[model samples]
Target: MGLLIGVGVLVLIALYFIGIYNSLVRARNEARNGWSQIDVQLKRRHDLIPNLVETVKGYAAHEKETLEAVIQARSAAVGAKTPGEAGKAEGMLGMALGNLFALSERYPDLKANENFLSLQEELSATENRIGFARQAYNDAATIYNNKREVFPANLISGGFEKAELFEIEIAAEREVPKVEF
Candidate 1:
């Protein structure tokens, strides 16, 4: 009877550890999926940028400095390999885009152009999607970080990768951009 009871206890302990390992795996996968969602939205944003720059270029050829800044910012954003790098690059891109829009306010005809208007609307919608995706990624990272740091889970979490939250690193980027047409 004593030997049978010891074997049963060992089985239960093994099952408990397995459960913890599985939970850790699930949380890590969720965090990864969340980051993937953000990447998809960012890709859409990247694809739209050149079209926007070209449309603006037709009207504001003399605004070479502003246009080039936008292009360069977009390139940096596309090349960013980590969440921290991406946040900084994207913040710069957002500021550059805001500058481009504010510059448009100076030209009455460009603001009214149908193609420009369509692009602006599409960009605005994509921005909203990006915002949501960023939020989701942050939430998932928080959850995974919590799971890994908790008492019992910490013992086996040594194999798990840490997730970094995507943050807007610029104070200026936090402000509501003026969207006047």
Candidate 2:
């Protein structure tokens, strides 16, 4: 009877550790997947920016400063290495793009151009997708962070090096700027 009880206790402990490790792994993967979702939308936006800029250039050749600003911002965004950096770069790019579009408003003919209109619609939709993806990333990160740091999970996570937090978010100041336009 004593040996059976000891064996049962060992099994329970083993199962507990395994469950904790598995949860940590699942949480970490969820966060990674969430970040990938953001990456996809960001890449889509990046791919569209050049076309959008070119379309605008055709209509507003004299707006060199605005166009240059947009190009610079896009370049910065592409060069960003981390999620935090990317967020800030994307915000700057958004502001520059907004300026470009606002300038486009001055040219009634540019606004009337069917190609420009189409690109604008697509860009707007992509922006919405980015917002959704960002939300998902934040949620996943929160879950993983909580699990890895919380008491019971941390016992196993710390011992096994189960999961590590990802550095994808920064302070509000560094986050993506709201698109007011």
Candidate 3:
């Protein structure tokens, strides 16, 4: 009878560990899926850039420097493979895009162009999606990290590494702009 009881207890312990292992795997997969969502939104934003730039180019032919900067920034952003690299490249792209838009302000015709307006709206929507995806990814990563660090799971999490948060390294991006009525 004692032999049977010992075997039963061992089986329960093995089951408990297996449960924890499975939960960790799910959390890791969720974090990865969150990142892929961000990537998709980023791709949409990238696709809109050339059209926006081309529309601006027709109106502001002399603004070659700003146009080239936007193109270069877009290339860097597209080439980024990891979250860390993407964050840095995206910051540059954002600044380049800001410059391009400011250049458009100088040319009333560019600002009024229907294609430019449409592309700008689409890019803005994509940026919003990217922001939401980043939030979701960071939340998932935090949850996974917590699961891996907690006592019971940490014992089982020997194989699991902490997931990286998609962090913005740019000080400007982190700062909130003031709005006054």
Quick one: best lDDT, which candidate? 1
Q: What is candidate 2's lDDT per residue for 50-110, written digit by digit as tens? A: 9988988888888899999889989999999986688788878887877877687688998
Q: Which stretches of candidate 3 lie over 4 Å from their true place?
A: 81-85, 169-181
Model 2 clashing residue pairs (backbone): none
TM-score of 3: 0.86
- TM-score per candidate: 0.83, 0.82, 0.86
- Per-residue lDDT of 123-177 in model 1, one digit per residue for the tens? 7777777778878888989999999999888988999988887664444343223
Q: What 10-residue stretch in candidate 2 is worst by lDDT? A: 171-180
lDDT of 2 at 52: 85
lDDT of 3: 0.79
Query: Number of clashes in every candidate structure?
Result: 0, 0, 0
lDDT of each: 0.84, 0.78, 0.79
Flag the better candidate by TM-score, 1 or 2.
1
In angstroms, give how far residue 148 of model 1 lies from its true place.
Answer: 2.3
TM-score winner: 3
Candidate 1 stretches greater than 4 Å from native: 81-84, 167-177
User: Who is ahead in lDDT, 1 or 2?
Assistant: 1
